[model samples]
Target: MNTTRTVRLGLPILLLAATAGLVAAPAAEARSLPTYTCGYTLDQPQFDSVRGRECTASAGAPLIGHHWITFQMRNSGSGETWVCNSVEAALVPYYLDNKIDPDYADFERAYGRGADASVCHRLLD
Candidate 1:
């Protein structure tokens, strides 16, 4: 199928699964939450494994662009952190509309793993 057609059809399903994953998500409750960060790198040409994009930004910065998105849920108390999958889903359209190029391949790839918690970052206050 064409890229646009594929995106039109697949995006809704991906969003639905991603949303379902969030409803059961645990609430953020702790005295101090660790700060987490995440990101992914494309498999470079002639490369073995993916590199860490280590996506970081100012707090409250909108993730609206064509590029990989990562969520790092860090523990402000102990410096521990993890990823939050729901936030990742909520950020997809932004990435697709702003970050992914006309090729649409990257958008598709991000959508493929859209439900993986490994890609989310939840910031605790």
Candidate 2:
């Protein structure tokens, strides 16, 4: 075949091969992390009136012995909020009815007024 015709035909085949390789390339897999939940009970009626109070966290794999985590509490009302941390886990709860971006973190909801806890942590695996 003439040089011009060969070049034109080869260019399309080259482009097609490149496109096919990209389409067939494996996608990057997403990493899955462990999740932990902290439970809370409203014992005081004065603090129980607030609606939508929750406690949550994204816990990481323990390093040396401690798992680096962020705890948050949000209360929309004028209620009370508390953080309870123990050797096993960390818990934040809305008492009077009282809430990051982390691969693994927790949250707590609040009531009455608005309350927010902002905390960030960097974890090295």
Best by TM-score: 2
Cα lDDT tens digits for candidate 2, 23-89: 9999999754433322332323343221222334445522112233333232324333433221123
Give the whole-model CA lDDT for all candidates, comma-separated. Answer: 0.42, 0.36
Q: Which digits, one per residue and each the tens of the lDDT, describe model 1 over residues 53-97?
A: 244434553343333444444323344445433233223343455
- Each model's number of backbone clashes? 23, 35
Candidate 2 Cα errors over 4 Å, as ranges: 39-125
Q: Tell me how far candidate 1 lies from the true structure as C-alpha RMSD in angstroms.
A: 23.1
Please report, as a residue range, the 10-residue window in candidate 2 with the lowest summed lDDT.
112-121
Point out where model 1 deviates above 4 Å.
1-36, 39-58, 66-90, 95-104, 108-125
**Whole-structure CA lDDT of model 1:** 0.42
